[model samples]
Target: MLFEDKYEIIRKIGSGSTSDVFLVRDRKLKKRWAAKIIGIYSGGGTDCRVKQDAAREIQILTQLDTPGAVKIIDVFEDSRRICILTDYIHGISLLAYIHKYGPVFEQTAAKWLLQLCGTLDYLHNMMPPVIFCDLKPENIMLKDDGKLTLIDFGAAYQQHSDVSPGIWKGTIGYAAPELCHGTAVPDIRADIYGLGVLGYFLISGLEPKQVEKLKDYSGHRIVSRKLDRILSGCLSENPGKRYKNCEHMAVRLRQFLRKADF
Candidate 1:
């Protein structure tokens, strides 16, 4: 209900299947925060599994120390609900920013994706290896300082062992083909696919799925032919045909920057 025994709920920012996100402020601390509350599921609302899942998500978020990753400040549970307190990222999300400014400058776009890739690298290489199941632009925030912060760990999962089956959950447009089959488990590469899809959107302003059906992208102003090739490669139908990994993709993206004198 109350945070740090001071901040009160101002209003709800967003809500999902199992939780409600509120924008709160602490007068004593003189800071803003995003608070996520989890409670019992009524009509497929919340349940024990969701509570346990929220706990796991908090644990994963707490381990992050990267700049572009959203910081988790505190976690607590009361008789009424499970609560997670996180820094209120100031500024709009990447999706909103892009919508307002058409496509971001190529250099700025590279900077954003690089920051995200750095965070993804950190996440994928954790001791137990953590996979950010969801990696869409909506989940990526752009701070006032021109830095990108990754948010929403509701779909995040830990890699138990090398042989463990991959999780099959992610947003449809961003989800990899294997996840769609619900048989083959996804891996870190799946995140790459999502990033690839993001790259496609940045260069072409068209989603990967839409690109497949369309004939050409030459009409796009900001993106050049060479850049389009790279985007297409990243969005390859077969994951195997795409970049080897985030590190590899980052390397190639850097090459693009260098060519552009970035």
Candidate 2:
């Protein structure tokens, strides 16, 4: 389907279970944007839960106004689908970058992790606290300016002490063990666990089977013991053993960067 008269669809960029993303250009503004079309209905009838999820995503996107996050441009809804337009990041996914360039340098990885930590801290400190359950490499885009932007808020949830535990919605390898067990309530620590996995991936170009089983980086001459300790702390199986919050983890990462002269 076509968007407004001003926007022209260029090509399909990505697709998921609920949405299809297209690279669209605005003739009037001469700018490119990512248009996500979310199907809200099935053959039988409208899917109320999907509709609510789309609305919730829009609400969360509107509240976010940070360089670390993708900015929402416009949102449109028709009888069949909901369309969300956002900035088209002019770069490749972190996953692609890693595949092309091999594992990132320690300094570069530290810089990116610091940025991610700050971004997570911002989300965790929001009014109701936003938990970004999905933080895998695919969801991270690296721009030409050397900045990283987090995308896809479909699995994000507002932290509410009153709310009961819900179904876990996150990437398998990157997801926290607590999420898989369904025994503990998810919170900011879940995101911390994701960050730890991301760090391990960036440094070693290998995905750990589980956060708790993260390989000892000391054996790798390139990995610093201090950095490994930080990653291990974040990857703790028990949430209580991890950093109290994203801010705390960010602080620790910054300290490591400074010590390493990054």
Candidate 3:
């Protein structure tokens, strides 16, 4: 219930299947931060796998130190729970933003995608290469300063070999087909697929289910030819057919932005 003597819990901000996140404040510095409290299990209460996942999330967050990604400030564990403190971002989730304001403009979507692509590139190029298995509107935060932040590392993994087999660990609609089917091993391309889905959702206000039914974005009048090509490639059913990597996609997106009159 109680965190470190210095941090005071304000309120619960969010909760997931395995953890609950809270808005906490440091008494010493008088600064706010988000703390994720993950329940620890010993013998039978919760699944052992869930505990491993929480530990893994803590490990990965501790390793990552990029501005685009949420920074982990402190980590502690007690007999019953594991607590992780990170910078408190002030703003709304991309999902809430879209629901409130409707689909974003093509130009605005392009800019957001560029920022996300750069972040993904950094993750995929890390020492062991972090694969952000989960990428969706809810996982992205639009800060008040007009920048984006990627949060929720519960599904992230460090790719050790060509294909690491594991259970599917992403949202249904936003996850890549390979990940959903559990037939193929997911790699960096999986994240590319997610980025494509995200772009479509932002520009068209269409969920992944609707997006998947359409053959292409040609039907969407707002989608420019260059943007359409990029989205199509990124959402390819086959991972191999998607963009080579996030960096490759970022380069293309930047080029598109340069030529786009909007």
Candidate 4:
């Protein structure tokens, strides 16, 4: 508070490999915020990797500036640390909801998937195009009003070329086949693949490993040949086989819906 911003800590909410997230309250404006603090050094030497990650995340979030994504409130960076303050999501993460309520109904999953499509579309359409390398269920927060917000941009990268070996990586089951190999620069299709995994999880409570073993959706409440076909396209090992863009996926998903509303 002496040299940095004016936010009082409420509690420590979450943490990641590079940062510690805290629930904080803005002193002047009296608003709630989530502050992610990353130490600039380890063992008395500057941790350039950590610092770059923290700085890049801040840059990405600032550029995003959209309603579907979490909004940034303030930031404080110094020789010792970098603190990023963002609007507190104040909602249950999709992963937590799934653990508590089990799988959702078919239409419910479709609705959320549609929302996700729009969000990803926004990201992929950015100037350099932002690719969310870590887009598992935990990073998606579900608000009380049924809206979904994408959170955590630590593993996100600008999509101009394939990622260099040590730049960024992703979750195993949720990440695409090419992404895990550390060569191919991931594209929007990678997020599409993740979206497919999420939709499967929401409708059938299946993980990626389980999805690979599945052929039919008979046992699950969400039974449809069209859905099976669509998900299969999304999970394709070859990115070229996936939907050209999120809009196409959203259109196909809407067609599979039993009701006209979407």
Candidate 5:
């Protein structure tokens, strides 16, 4: 189908519960775009809610103009689907890269972490502070130019003034422990915990549980002790014990990079 009077659907690329993404080409502009088609349901039901959520993701992404974030060009809705057109990214997802390359080198991982830290800090320091509920490697992509872009803002939300307890939104392995309790609100600290999990996976080639299973290492013998310590601190089960915010975490990571000559 036609979208925005320019983008013509070539084929489906990817999909999620809320939307289906298609690879499209702009006939007039002669550019490629990933068009996310969200289903629209009437009668104010679950489908309607899904559309709302999809729209919210687009809204949140549009507001974030950071280099580390994906670039969205426009959004459109027909009777069947709500389409979000974004710049086509040409690189493998971080998850695919790790599986293929078998974890990243120390310096490479540090560089990636720093980029993500900067991105998260930018999001957290905003007036409303965008909370990215999904921060796993699967949600991150490595551009062909070796740059990083945080994708899938479906779970992003702005902080509310009420400050009341709320249900958590994040993945299991990478999600903060406080989130599992269902009483915590999404905040910058949650991102810190997720980053820690990401660090462990990227540097040690092991997940948090695997790192735990390495009881033989005594926590101090792991490769890159400095990095391990940072990851362990960031992945703390206690939210209060994690980094105060993305800014603090970035500072620590920056220091480590400089010391390690990354």
Candidate 6:
């Protein structure tokens, strides 16, 4: 569909429970952008609630200005839809990369961890900090330049934003147990749990769901405890057992890397 009488839809690139993403091009600028279209209209007239949710995501995007995030270039709204225009990222999902290239090496994982932690730290430190409740490998994109970007923010919610219940929470194995059950309010620990799951999968080349049975490390023997210690805590069923936040987790990572000298 044509939008704003200028942005032409190239094709549908992706979709989510709440919206569909299309690759669109600006006729004047000859630049491409990903437009996430969220339906805000119903049979009667307008779905105020849906519009509110769309606005929430747009608001969160505007506050984000980090390399780890896809930059928001513009926004468009009509009678029936809200379009969030963001930079078109050309990359592979972390999960897809791991499948094709095997688990990332220790050195690579360490570098990636710092980048992710820095990104999350920025998100968590926002004015009304945003929590990326869903952070599985599928949500992270690895660019050709070796930089990682958090591509999906549909589940990101501002801290104490008075959101209604029944919203999308998180994944099963990757999400913190509390999020799985919708028992505890989302916090930094939830993303930490996801980091643990992703880290374990990358290092072991095994599924996080089988983290118990595959009690083995496929990488180096040195990172066995140093990295696993923190990751294990992140996988804890209880949030208290996980690192307080990204800053706390990054400190451990840096300390371990310095000692391991990898």
lDDT string for model 1 (129-225, tens) is: 7888677777888888878888788877777732234444467787777666565566677788788677656654565567563335565355666
lDDT of 4 by residue, 129-244 (tens): 99887878888999988899988888888887435754565788898888887657778988988888888888777776787545555654353566767777788888999998
lDDT tens digits by residue: candidate 6, 69-112: 99888988889888899988898988888899987766578778
Which pairs clash (backbone N, Cα, C closer than 3 Å) in model 3?
none
Off by over 4 Å in 2: 1-4, 161-164, 210-222
Worst 10 contiguous positions by lDDT, candidate 2: 210-219
TM-score of 4: 0.91
Q: What is the lDDT of residue 197 in candidate 5?
A: 82
Give the alpha carbon lDDT tens digit for every residue of 60-152 in model 2: 899998899998999988889999999999898998888888888777887898999889889899998888888899899999998999988
How does residue 87 of candidate 1 score in lDDT?
85
* Candidate 1 residue-wise lDDT at 232: 60
Lowest summed lDDT window (length 10), candidate 1: 161-170
Candidate 4 at residue 236, lDDT?
A: 86
- Assess the local accuracy of residue 154 in candidate 2 as a C-alpha lDDT between 0 and 100: 80
Query: Using lDDT as the measure, what is the rank order of every candidate, best first?
Result: 3, 2, 4, 6, 5, 1
lDDT values of the candidates?
0.73, 0.84, 0.84, 0.82, 0.78, 0.81
2 or 6, which is superior by lDDT?
2
Between prediction 5 and prediction 6, which has the larger lDDT? 6
Candidate 5, residue 146: Cα displacement in angstroms equals 1.4
Steric clash pairs (candidate 5): none
Model 5 per-residue lDDT tens digits across residues 87-129: 7888988888988888677778878988998999999988888
| Error in Å for residue 193 of model 3 | 0.4
Candidate with more favorable, higher lDDT: 2 or 4: 2
